[model samples]
Target chain A: MKKHIAVVSGDGIGPDIVREALKVLFAVGAKFGHTFTTSSYLAGGAALDAVGIPLPEETLDGCRNSDSVLLGAVGGPKWDTLASNLRPEKALLGLRGGLGLFCNLRPAILYKQLSDACPLKAEIIGEGLDLMVVRELTGGIYFGERGRTDDAAFDTMAYTVGEIERIVRKAFEIAQKRSKRLCSVDKANILNTSQLWREVVKRVQGDYPDVEVSHLYVDNAAMQLVRNPRQFDVIVTENMFGDILSDEASQITGSIGMLPSASLREDSYGMYEPIHGSAPDIAGKDLANPIATILSVAMMLRYSFGLQAEADCIESAVSKVLDNGYRTADIHTPGMKKIGTNDMGSLIAQSL
Target chain B: MKKHIAVVSGDGIGPDIVREALKVLFAVGAKFGHTFTTSSYLAGGAALDAVGIPLPEETLDGCRNSDSVLLGAVGGPKWDTLASNLRPEKALLGLRGGLGLFCNLRPAILYKQLSDACPLKAEIIGEGLDLMVVRELTGGIYFGERGRTDDAAFDTMAYTVGEIERIVRKAFEIAQKRSKRLCSVDKANILNTSQLWREVVKRVQGDYPDVEVSHLYVDNAAMQLVRNPRQFDVIVTENMFGDILSDEASQITGSIGMLPSASLREDSYGMYEPIHGSAPDIAGKDLANPIATILSVAMMLRYSFGLQAEADCIESAVSKVLDNGYRTADIHTPGMKKIGTNDMGSLIAQSL
Candidate 1:
């Protein structure tokens, strides 16, 4: 099989970690008797510095031509002084909007080795935490009409029935693939947006008879995520609420550095990236964790390239490395051998 | 001092908890040399049943004439099938809106003896968790324009300059009186409402010279609350965001049954209530926890009646009872004796 993957080595430690993901990808390709061609492109603060645009047209073209797009984390304080419109974070957000990617799948899985590190009790954390959060990427409060006046300011939490139905349908499809359980989270008890959300979700649920559907107020859902994360299978929510809930869900795994996300449209190709931001404070240093970016590569393989075996290989290799007591600063557990950026990445690749 | 309190024992566990809170209130009044008179009114499902209106005109008149109002939980499944406008929860929400109760303060405090009940590690949970969540009760998505069409729906997240200023000022004022630290949580990185929120908070900081101000995105704030809840002193956010975040914050202390909230307007007396909802399933069994309602009574004394000693007495009594390991179903910590609702209430009053 031949696959072309576009890589965006975004900023700070993005390049270093991305290198390891590529190595792991190459190893998987070889093991599975498959060939993968990688193309690298500039984005985020680095692109702004090099080519004067956070997301250059060349980068978009490269991604559109590829089987999948893998991104390292973006933005740093160095670009903080940039105009809000030209800031590095916008590049990532803009790409999602520009690509018409409406479904963001963020899987929050707690590994057995990292269970003790979670704030929740061992009993509450359960054996395996596997929940996919299907966040509506292009709609809701994030892209709503927003502005500030001298006396007032406002942002809309708008949702189209078409948008809600599509995202809900996507979530139901994913649930069909997984545990066949879906929980739609909204603030229906208070907000009008949520009331409409509930109505649309109910209508959408009728289409998926196999999927078990439940509704939770956002506040209760947030509490339940920490109290018993194992209870959830697939959580679908609006953009801003999903943005907040998904991050909190990542924390349940006891490692933000291990979480990866993918934003996709109806097409097979998608943008994959680690959940963490560019830590400018630790940029030049070797302290940034690379597992998140590496895991993202695994997602790119499974979700985009349809190389499940190769994706499993990358995932298993990372798990084995962690099982061997390797640690990065962000996810350091007791007695784990603390390793730097290149060393950890090398260990993962070596395991692969 | 002499005071009259409008007591609205709502529905479900409303009457049970209100009875306990009144016992403690009477004890506090006697201990502090204050004269207290309570007029019990019907609201919520019960009021709707009796007067055919959730918030009766007489009840509103009672609240306006009284020095303070203490509400037990509202709503039940019996009334859930009623019209949306006639439902029980609408009454509580109606009172807040009608009374112009803008500042909603929910304090998440972990008792010393109950610290063992926290799911997080003792080192992370630390000695005590006390943080007041100041939510703008009157504005944002709650009261914003909302509508649903055949294919789309919208809910505005609007904030006026005056609303933001007042809420931020209230938070800083509360912070100055406590740990001298305030955290303003918003989605500033994404929403225009939050962007204006940040600017308003900065401008308001000048007025509170002694307090330190910190800003965090709502997502990061949610993670930090779980990661290290002890780091925060006070958190001020918009209405809907606060609704979710405060609930999450309350869960960190192990049970929603232990948290209380106070909603106040500038010129009027405040309304105090427990953060927990009516547990319709356990309404008649006398199994619901009443500590939150009792604590809410304490808040009514302090914030509305200016009865500091009376408030302190009620708080101390509740803590002493918890120290004695009298458990309710909600806070069923290990090895703790689970007692019935009335017994726990009696124990708290006995401690007083």
Candidate 2:
């Protein structure tokens, strides 16, 4: 198989972590007998430094021409003073919009080796939690019309049948691959948009007859996430609820530094990245964790490249490294052998 | 001090719990040399059963004539089949609207004796969790205009300067009484209403110069609640955000049966109730936990009746009862003295 990968190593530790991820990817390519070509594109603060824009048109074109995009973390205090539209984070929004990415997949997996870091009690965690949050990335209140008058301000939360149908179908498909359980959360009892969301979810359930579906009010859903996170398989919600819930779910795992995320459009074209932000403080210090970025390459293999075996191999290598007691600075324990970013990457690649 | 209280014990365990709370209230009245007049009103499922409507005009009239209202849980499976307008929960909504109650106070308190029930790690819950959520109840998406087209549905989340000012002032006053720190939660970076909310909160801060104010986005706030709940003193947000966050905060305590809430209007006039619902399964079986209702009585005394010492006495008595290992069926554990609703209430009142 042959694939073209666009790499956007944005700023700070972003370049370092992305380098490690590329090392692991190349190792996987060699072992799995695949030909992979990579193109480095300037974006975020890196682009702003070279050019006067956060997201250069040339970079977006490069990503568009590639099979899939792999992004390192973006933004830091260096670009915080810029205008909102010109800020480093705007590059992310620009890419999502330009690529038509509508679904964000955030998986919160509490590894057995890291169970001690979980905020929840052992009894409540109950054999560890591994659930995916399928968030509708490009719609809902975030994209809705908003304005302010002299005395009042308003924001519209609107949803169309088409938007709901696609996200629901994606969630169901994801659920079908996992535990066959999909919990669709919304404030149906109160919001008209949520009522329509529920209606469309039920309509889409017919397409995936094997997937079991359930609905919970947003408030109750938030409570349930803390009360029994183990009960969820694939939880899906609109943009704002997902933003809130996905963050909550990630925090409960107590290992944000080790999590990977994917934002995808309708096709297999997706951008995978680590959920953590670029640590400018640790930049060039080789102290950053690259596991999240490395695991993101695994997600790209499974979701974008459709290489299940290759994805499994990368994941297994990560587990093997952890089993051998190798740890990055962020997740290092007392008895663990703490390694720098490059060593962690090389170790996982060597395991592969 | 003379006080007129309107008691509406709705359905299921509502009557049982309200009776116990009234028992405690009367005991306080007798011990504190206060003249307390009580009138029982029909509302919720009781009103629906008696007059085929959830909120009878007479009940609203009774609440209006009284200084404050004390309500038990409302709704049950029996009334689930009723029309939306006639549902038992409608009674509470109607009272809030008719009485012009715009501020909701939900306190998530983790008792030291009940700390074992909390789901969060001890470090995260240091010194026991005690935070208040001051929610703007009467406005925002819940009351905003909502409608559906053939292919799309939308709900408006709007907030007026007056609305934001009143809630912020109420929160500041409450914060002034407690920690003097108020954290206003909003999606200010995205939504226009939240931007206006943040603006209003800042404008109101000048009025309360002694109170410290901070801001947090709703998503980060949700994560922070699970990560470090102790960092919050009083959190204020719009209706929808509050509805979700307050529930999450309460669940962290792992003692929903022991939580009480207050809905207040402009003045000291307010309606106090337990945050729990009518447990149809436990109705009339003497299995209900009366602590939440009794605590609601304590809130009423503090917020409405201006009887701080009396409220303190009631709170102290409840804590003393818990310290003595007297547990209701809801919060019961091995080796604890398990008691029924009536006995638990009597014990608390006796301690008072």
Task: Report every candidate's CA lDDT.
Answer: 0.86, 0.93
Leading candidate by DockQ: 2
Docking model 2 quality class: high
Q: Tell me the lDDT of candidate 1.
A: 0.86
Compared with the true structure, what per-residue lDDT tens digits does model 1 show for residues A299-348? 88887777788788888988999999998888886788998887888888
**Against the hidden reference, what TM-scores do the models get?**
0.97, 0.98
Off by over 4 Å in 1: A284-287, B333-335
- The residue-by-residue lDDT of candidate 1 on B1-352, one tens digit each, is 8889899999999888888888888877787788889898889999988999899989888888888899998998888888778888888888898888899999998887777667666777777788899999989988888887777778888998899998888888889889999999998878888888899998888888899989998999989988888889999999988988998888888767888899988854899999998887898788989999999988888787767777888889888887777899887778888998899888988888
lDDT of 1 at B46: 92
With a 3 Å backbone cut-off (N, CA, C), the pairs that clash in candidate 2 are none
Output the number of the lDDT-best candidate. 2
TM-score of chain B of each: 0.96, 0.98
lDDT of 2 by residue, A1-352 (tens): 9999999999989999999999999999999999989999999899999998999999899999999999998889999999888999899999999998899999999988888888888889988889999999998889988888989999988999999888888899889889999999998767889989998998889889999899999999899999999989999999999999999999999999889999988989999999999999999899999999999999999999999999999999999999999999899999999999999999999999
